[model samples]
Target: MSDASPVHFIAHFTVTDGDGYHNYEKRFFPVLKPYGAKFITFDDNVTVLEGEREAGRTVIIQFPSEKVLMEWWNSPEYRELAAIRHQATTTFSVSVIHAIPQR
Candidate 1:
């Protein structure tokens, strides 16, 4: 499991607030400092789907561990960003999932 990847499945809904999304993305990692999400990606853009996937944008946050992932998900820091996201989008759905270690 040492070499295995850690990824969290996430989907976000944006009300489409103006300005560069980069602004938020830059600060997000730092804000998630305490809980620690190592990497965040807007995934669907890179991969193609044959049919309908989740309606909203798909993001993956690689955490230090599964426990940390849960902690971060509930952390107030994340909650703060969530508020901004909500305002930016009509709605959002966040799901926390652990990837099976690649053997």
Candidate 2:
């Protein structure tokens, strides 16, 4: 994909500490504001149609491009917030998906 290709941040996890995770959720949007991201969806009930993947809370966030997404992801602000998530949740996987390029 090209540098301008959009990217999606997908995370699947189970919250182990409600209070701490909640704290992360509440402050997430504000921290994301300056990053030019779109909070697409947050679903606690995920239907895994196939595979051995277990269902859990799923979060999807879209960023205009991979560069922007990386900047936000590697930022100190997000790192601090992610520390809370790491401590409060049993993370299954977090991935960055690139959008298909136009033909």
Candidate 3:
């Protein structure tokens, strides 16, 4: 197998408008497919074991590389759908993380 590590796109957000957020969710998976993105986890049942916990939903998506991740994020189709997410959520935060390879 190739040693390339996958990159994760992590999002933490609180929904302000459920219907609007649901609209965004409907389009999420289809848009991701073209970029080879896969959902690692999407959870609302989060527990904090250490530092301060933020109240919201957490989503983790994985891509083969940063380039692929950016391509998905910067796509015109995604940008259009992202507006729905912006309108539906409050305190949205997204981060890209590179997985560390095991020795």
Candidate 4:
């Protein structure tokens, strides 16, 4: 990661109902795209050992900067989609971290 091109560390993890994933992907994947991020990976499985076996998903996105991400998240278009995702999902983790700037 270079100083000039700010990198973002993003993680989206969750356990979901098998049926609910289609809607989420159809609706939510679009919501996360406007930030001009590189879709590094999207996984649809979460394994638990101690707890009961469950189905889950994870999405990783890499943005150029925190500012761009904030711009996308705070925009009006995403606001509506976010509301839908909140209603359709059980649990999710969405985190963004700024990459260390290079010298």
Candidate with maximal TM-score: 2
What tens-digit string does per-residue lDDT give for candidate 1 at 1-103? 5423465757665537654344556567787777656666775344545764444566667777666776776788878776766666654577766666566
Model 4, stretches more than 4 Å misplaced?
1-4, 13-21, 46-55
Give the whole-model CA lDDT for all candidates, comma-separated.
Answer: 0.63, 0.89, 0.86, 0.64
User: Considering summed lDDT, which 10 consecutive residues are worst modelled in model 3?
Assistant: 1-10
Candidate 2 stretches greater than 4 Å from native = none
Pairs of colliding residues, candidate 3: none
5: Cα error in model 4, Å: 4.0
lDDT per residue for candidate 2 within 21-57, as digits (tens), equals 8999898898898988999998987676877766569
Report the poorest 10 consecutive residues by lDDT, candidate 4.
Answer: 9-18
Question: Of 1 and 2, which scores higher on lDDT?
Answer: 2
**What is the descending TM-score order?**
2, 3, 4, 1
- Clashes per prediction? 4, 0, 0, 0
Query: What's the TM for model 4?
Result: 0.66
Residue 56, candidate 2: alpha-carbon lDDT? 66
Inter-residue clash pairs, candidate 1: 14-89, 15-88, 15-89, 15-90
Cand. 3 Cα-lDDT? 0.86
Task: Give the alpha carbon lDDT tens digit for every residue of 1-103 in model 3.
Answer: 2335678899999998999999999998999898878899988878888887577899999999888888888999999999888899975678988876567
Using lDDT as the measure, the top candidate is: 2
- Which scores greater on TM-score, model 2 or model 3? 2
Which lDDT value does model 4 have at 38?
A: 80
